[model samples]
Target: MFEVEVKYRVPNHDAIRDRLKALNAKFLEHTEETDIYLNSPLRDFAKTDEALRVRVYGDGTVVLTYKGPRIGNVGKTREELSVTANDLDSLLEILRRLDFREVAKVVKRRDIYNYENFTIYLDTVEDLGSFVEVETMVNDKELINRATDEVLQFGDKLGLKREWIEKRTYLELVLERGNERR
Candidate 1:
């Protein structure tokens, strides 16, 4: 599937949560996520704008995801393939044996909400402060552009300003912060 989303840096989630309540958005579960990012030995995923991740949720569920390079200039649109993993240690061992090296670990608490056709994610990232992500998934590649527009429009409807929109991924932000500190 293609994941079409836009992320915004916000001071806090209070305003967005109120707006979501006003819109009668359905509240989903709140969960903490630990994402482990890996790098391929053969290529530089950072240069290619691709990602491989192992996500362990607070409920003990584990997921393996491969995200392709970003497709368009409008939004953070990409082809995402994901599957559930039964064993996190075994999966990490397999990836390590295959020469995939761990690059970064990101932890965040996420509150999910559903309004209309969009899944809204309110995230409080470790060390990175708060963010809101508006996202939708589409199976057809042709629908990506339209989906991107809709995601942005939905964010605007929720009082998210375009100026606050952030195109960088959490991992990128973390890496940049590390570089700045060094």
Candidate 2:
């Protein structure tokens, strides 16, 4: 399945939260996430526009995810595959044994909301500040474009400006920030 998403850098998260509340969005869990990104030894994922990461949630559940390249210009629509891992350390060890090297870590607090078919995230990254992401999952390739449009439109309903859309991934943003400090 493809995960269609639209993300924006918003200055006020409380405003977005209020908007969600007014819209009667179902409040999901608020949790902290620690994402550990890995690079394949065989190829440069950065160049290929692919991503591999292990996400550890606040309650200690681990999820390993693989995100393919973006599908279209409308939003961050990509083929995402994920699995829950029972053992976090073993999972990392297995990846290491297979030659995957850890590259970066992104820590964030996330408030999740469900509105109709969309899942929204109000995220505050440790170094990157506040943002809102709207997403939906689609199984058919033909539905990708439509899903992307819907995701963007939902973001619009939440009062996000088109110009505020951020295309860069959190890994890229974090790495860029690290470079700037060097």
Candidate 3:
């Protein structure tokens, strides 16, 4: 499951949401993902300078991802892990008790999934203004290239990143932009 993706700066969420609705897409609940980066002594974790995070995506969509996992290292993989959600309260209650380690910033991101096999996420960081992400999984180089092209086409359609093909994870860009905003 190689993940090929791109992102752009969105003018506004409402504008994008309208387009998504026109495409028969729905806005999923906003997910507050919390990442806890750690220090490792060996293996890939030690060689790189990134953070380890335990992400909680709305309700019970819990996952543990590196704050800065090497770019493209886990790109082509079914790398996401989400938890079962009966209701959001139980999950929120659990999070309230745990003392989560803080990082440089906390990001509030809205997830919009296209029934057409793509997911668009709108992120609003503590400092960063606004950004959007389009992610799709592909296998083989040709398909990956095609997917990249497709994403680029949509980006153009949306008037985003028309020339800049960005592949950084949402976290990295948001963090950098957020830091700059301050």
Estimate TM-scores for all models: 0.98, 0.97, 0.64
Q: Rank by lDDT, highest first.
A: 1, 2, 3
- lDDT value for model 1: 0.95
Kindly list the per-residue Cα lDDT of model 2 for residues 10-96, writing each as its tens digit: 996988989999999999899999999999999999999999999999999999999998889867889988999989999999999
Let me know the TM-score candidate 2 reaches against the reference structure. Answer: 0.97
Residue 85 lDDT, candidate 1, scale 0-100: 91
Residue 136 in model 1: shift from native, Å? 0.6
Misplaced by over 4 Å in model 3 are 43-51, 66-105, 163-182
Worst 10 residues of 2 by lDDT: 145-154
lDDT of each: 0.95, 0.93, 0.56
- TM-score (C-alpha, index-matched) for candidate 3: 0.64
In candidate 1, residue 176 scores what lDDT?
92
Tell me how candidate 2 scores on lDDT. Answer: 0.93
Model 1 poorest ten-residue lDDT run:
71-80
Ranking by TM-score: 1, 2, 3
Alpha carbon deviation, residue 169, candidate 2 (Å): 0.5
Cα RMSDs, all models: 0.7, 0.8, 5.7
The candidate with the higher lDDT, 1 or 3, is 1
